[model samples]
Target: MPLPTTLVWLPETVSTDEEAFLLAAHFLGESLDGLSLSRDPLGKPYPARQGHSIPCLHISNTHDGGQRLLLAAKHENLVGVGLDMVYLPRMRSPYKNRAYLHRLAARFMAHVEFERFQRAAQQDDEEALRRRVAAHFSLMEAASKALGTGLKIGAFMGHSASLPLSALGALQIEPWVQLFFDDLAKTRLVTLKAQRWEAYWGSDDTYLISAVFLFGNEQSKQALQLDYP
Candidate 1:
């Protein structure tokens, strides 16, 4: 089955806000020369096309030198689109810090949720482990912000309604990443299709980086399947 979708994971080579923007524009079928994007006077990225309609779509996410770009069309419309990306390593400082673990757990937990996560971490449950891995998706909040609607409106928790960030400990944030994405997939604002990608660099392999691309829609399963590889 061919699904309607397009996604790209940016490696460290194209490392910069400008490069990230261009890559995203490319996914959504926009030329860098055609659109003028500047850090708005208000510090937001707005299209230079003031009076013209910007299609109520287009988004980008960048973190730790990686970017995820998604290109999607409206529900069979083929015009509307949106995208998002994030870098995984930047969200936490120095892996395996006990204090950092406690701090994140406290911030993410909602009483009962926190305790369950703690038990999972303590018991070494595989399911709990994955949820903890997805905690890295917390950075998606910032990715969503880059997409247009800041974190205030697009909560990462909302994206990953199943596995909350606060539930897991400091091992990994992949679970939250998965959940956050699932949430976006369910939204009507823009039919979203996303992909997860990763890369490694440095002699010591100091970076464990991942990114997500949320596009407009995958009218066909063929395109959507591309998300896996």
Candidate 2:
């Protein structure tokens, strides 16, 4: 079966994290009141029942500007999953300025990754560069979240070796997506497979959405699937 992932777009007036949950409950055809939810020590939400875990389902959520998206995977054999969405505006103007951009690259990017961003930025116009950087950041964040480490340990691990600047410039999803699996193998941070989806909302709004599945091994490349709109 395909990955049970779902995306929900919320209007500006009603945008909230809770809406994602509501959509999940709707997608599952269950009333929100019937589901028991709990958070781990790190504050990630998961499904629970009578203080026991629900092993069959995994969920992750993210929001950007006025839009919210969720990923719900029903896996009889898989483990954990993570989702992330980044707003295009988050990486625009002052945020993408030289000083701020350099700081962000230093914080989350390895030296080689930073170099690639630099090269790409020099070649592309400001808007294109901003979108690429935002998407990269979103993917990294999604991977980290899938590992249950958030940005603490996962972000610092070396990813540039797998996700080179050349892949980003190639503008091909397959090559770019492969880098996530490659990074997982090289770092062994967590055994997971990742896939990303990009969406354009309004005339001016764009988002980079990513998901990662955990406990996935070599065969995961074949088992994992992504649904994009």
Candidate 3:
């Protein structure tokens, strides 16, 4: 069967990451009604029942400053899904410092990504550059999570080194991502709508959250249908 097309979002009300995860699980259990939840050896959550092979319902959650987001899906065979969220920093924030940004790029981004960030920083507004970098990192984190390898050992790590930014660029399309699932974990570029909500500091803030759904043995170009605003 095709992967689940529905993507649900819960409001931000939790104080910590653990609380956010619990809220997401609660929402998922309620959404599925009778489905029971279980965790694998690695701590990934899924739906399960007795006398039958448990169907894989990939779940990923992220939180920042009391805001939480979750992405979930049930893929027919077995597929991996990942989710990540980030707070978009304002231009006056620490992230806007070139040195700090470069440090992050060196630590987590590939050469190509660093170049892209440099170019964007030179030509675009600080806010735009921040969003671009945050979005890229979120996607990379999501893909890594989907592979159950995290960033340290997944596609972000290339040839026993950090994965190249060009590799991530190649995954901007569904087919390429699917083809390189073993390495890239099916990460594709999709519309990420910025969300605005009141922060714990009693001020309005913006966030950028992303998800990578559908990584598996099968090769398909189909992209998940996500509706967010």
Scored by lDDT, the top model is 2
TM-score: model 3 vs. ground truth: 0.60
lDDT of each: 0.38, 0.54, 0.48
RMSD of each: 9.2, 7.3, 9.5
Which is better, 1 or 2, measured by lDDT? 2
What pairs collide in candidate 2?
none
Clashes of each: 28, 0, 3
Q: Tell me the spans in candidate 2 whose CA falls farther than 4 Å from its real position.
A: 10-19, 29-34, 94-103, 119-122, 153-175, 179-204, 215-219, 222-229
Candidate 3 on 1-229: residue-level lDDT in tens? 5545334455544454434444554654534334455655455555554423245555666666456666666655445666777776543486466566567656666564565557556764655555555655667766555544454444435333223333342123211231122233233221111111001111124777666654443333443323211
lDDT of 1 at 6: 38
Q: Residue 110: error of model 3 in Å?
A: 2.7
List the candidate 3 regions with Cα displacement exceeding 4 Å.
Answer: 1-6, 11-34, 51-53, 90-95, 116-122, 152-205, 217-219, 222-229
1-229, model 1: which lDDT tens digit per residue? 2223334556667665556655656666665565555553224454444434354433334344433433322122223222333233443455635445656655654454455556657755443333343343333333343333333222432332223333321222323322222333224223322332221111112233333333344432223222211
- Kindly report which residue stretches of model 1 are placed more than 4 angstroms away from their true locations once superposed: 1-19, 31-33, 38-42, 46-53, 65-100, 108-113, 119-122, 125-229
Which has the higher lDDT value, candidate number 2 or candidate number 3?
A: 2
TM for every model, in the order presented, reads: 0.43, 0.65, 0.60
Q: What is the C-alpha local distance difference test score of candidate 1?
A: 0.38
